[model samples]
Target: MDRDAVRLTVMKHDEPWAGAATTTGRNGSVPHQVGAPGALAESLFLVPTRHLVALRDVLRSGEDPEGVAVELGAAAATEGIGWSELLRDVEDVCRSVSGSLPPYEVVRAMSIAWTETAIHDAYETSCEDPLTGLASAAHLRSRLDDAYRLAERSGVSASETAAFVVVEIAAGSGPDVGLLRSLSMLVLADAMRTCFDGDETIARVGEHRAVALVRRSDAIRGYRALRDLLERAVDLPPLRVWVEGLPATSDAATRLLGELGRGASATELG
Candidate 1:
């Protein structure tokens, strides 16, 4: 059987055909209908039977497929496509190439895109926000549970053990707000580390807001000290500082963060 004997028919997104990858020949490029909905998707595409669309790039006939692979990987991740499924797709592509697993370089590039997007998906509903290096609201609730549990064992209220020291930075409505907010938070986080010691968890619960779990025993005293440090380290105008006592339960504590997070500038320490 001649491996090159297959008759490949490349179809367009605008074509009347329903976007199928039906194969009829013994050897040739396998054509899958491009599903992108755009008038700009008029470019012609012919894919190898192994489903390796990069064959064009590999054969120096069309645009780069590296970006395509990345987009596929990212799309797979967001769509909740599993690894096994992705491997099957890879296998189809490989059949046109090595007829085995995908080439290491291609796999690496795709895997990187997949992993990055997958991690973002996890972070969206999980413990931490990668950009801010702070605990998500969900993470804070669990930490609160631990604090309350320990407090219970020690025969004290949660408030006796934990409190939130919040820092809210004020930025103008200018276009630079995102950059300004991030930089200000970094400065605030650094000051938080210096003043709060290592035991507390710091979290960003709202835009331009961060809260560090502080020892209520020292929160009042520490607030004044941290306020002094923030003033010195940050030249950005008007930083607000306040201490919020933990409520009776972790549930309430999570809600408290929302309330404290509102408004710009300092309020009297409560």
Candidate 2:
């Protein structure tokens, strides 16, 4: 196809693909190469083998080109479908992308990525009580390591810094243990999000606790800001939280999280 014809005729099922074509084709030139797809794959942050098959399926077909093309374009349209139908193809595409690679390796990488994202998102959504996410204790362990690395890499280590803000929420006797648990998670999530930055991390390590890893040069101000934010975060039901501060030592994150978890249990009984 000529440059104008290619621009007009090539249908893009993914926004990232369209963006790649447009961005790479600027200055009146068509990319004229498969490299565009590779670049698009990189831009979307997709691991090539993980997404290549799925992306190709979305844009190509076998003998029944006309029929498949029509279906593809229809799926790309924004309307005229049941909710399930709308998502069904997209889900298939994602699965195909993830599935085509060597199953064990792809699954392993995706599992790690998925858990990391889940831990971060869960901490963001239900921070008041980290345990509400019911994440495996191992997830918090991983996040601690992640936080430690982030702090160490901050590039401004000359200044002293508070490494983490840990919160332990203990359930009281009569508050529906479940509701209090739920409330605690909400609060924990809030507290974590409140304290997090691009370089921060949050995770849950106990049945009723959460913690955040922060890198603030001014420890007192960071702690105060976090404390005040949690104090005003009202979504969570009544509960007692013990907050602690720790320096961003080379390996204090796990110990801090462990302390918060144990403290929550002790505080609950006391």
Candidate 3:
């Protein structure tokens, strides 16, 4: 199938007959009807049959179908689309299904689901460490940007709410390289959850360094948590370490991560 053509159709639903309902052929792309008032009905024909089934199940289980549809549609989009139009589509679908789910509930569920799905996908694809399940540095930036934007929109300065904690883990001496790396990951996961909570953003940028972004107010507490995690590192013998605190400035944060990468690779004490 021509992905480009299908992508084009996904983006522009301007024509009344350009959607799934209007196009009927055995071709891989589903036929859809494209129009304003009937957009939801058209969308049903456009989404893949399996996805449609999953969507139906969500609705049947007392979930908001409109919200589920918005997430599923956005999730499936590999190409770019106008954010305004996408949001419009979501609003329209939610309104159409208002009878099944409360209007406000549909709005809330879809908004949250959209955000959660987007975050999870971004972390999975761009920000997770394949080796140990820690977040990657790029993902760290994305997380910070999202959080900072949220704070800023809510009338808080970006710097007022965020802090960075860099944990430099010294590897074990001798031939216990594998054990050392495993220990580092364990320490990271524990420190992340205990200090920053499950919602906190943490990342492993190098073999010997992990960084966590915490609430600015929690800087001291976060540091204490790191200390505890490091103390547990004694199980790996030489895999001990010192911790450092840094402000989570957007630009400075990037530079700090870079410095950490170089410093951790060097023989300097943390």
Q: Tell me the alpha-carbon RMSD of every candidate.
A: 18.7, 19.7, 17.6
- The whole-model lDDT of each prediction reads 0.62, 0.44, 0.54
Listed in order, each prediction's TM-score against the native is 0.54, 0.38, 0.44
Per-residue CA lDDT of candidate 3, range 1-270, in tens? 111111000011112233344544333434333454524444432333344344545654666567566655555442222334344544444445443433565455545555666564565467677656778878887887787578768887555676566665555567877677766677566666676675777887766777777776776666665566656655533333333333334565456567666664323312
Off by over 4 Å in 3: 1-125, 154-156, 232-234, 237-249, 264-270
Ranking by lDDT: 1, 3, 2
Report the lDDT tens digits of candidate 1 across residue range 167-255.
Answer: 77875678988888887777777777788777888877767778888787777677777887876773674676766667776666655
lDDT string, candidate 2, 173-217, tens digits: 674777767666766675656556455556666666655544544
- Residue 13 lDDT, candidate 2, scale 0-100: 18
Please identify model 2 stretches exceeding 4 Å from their true place. 1-137, 146-162, 195-197, 235-253, 264-270
Error of 1 at 256 (Å): 2.0
Q: Judged by lDDT, which candidate is best?
A: 1
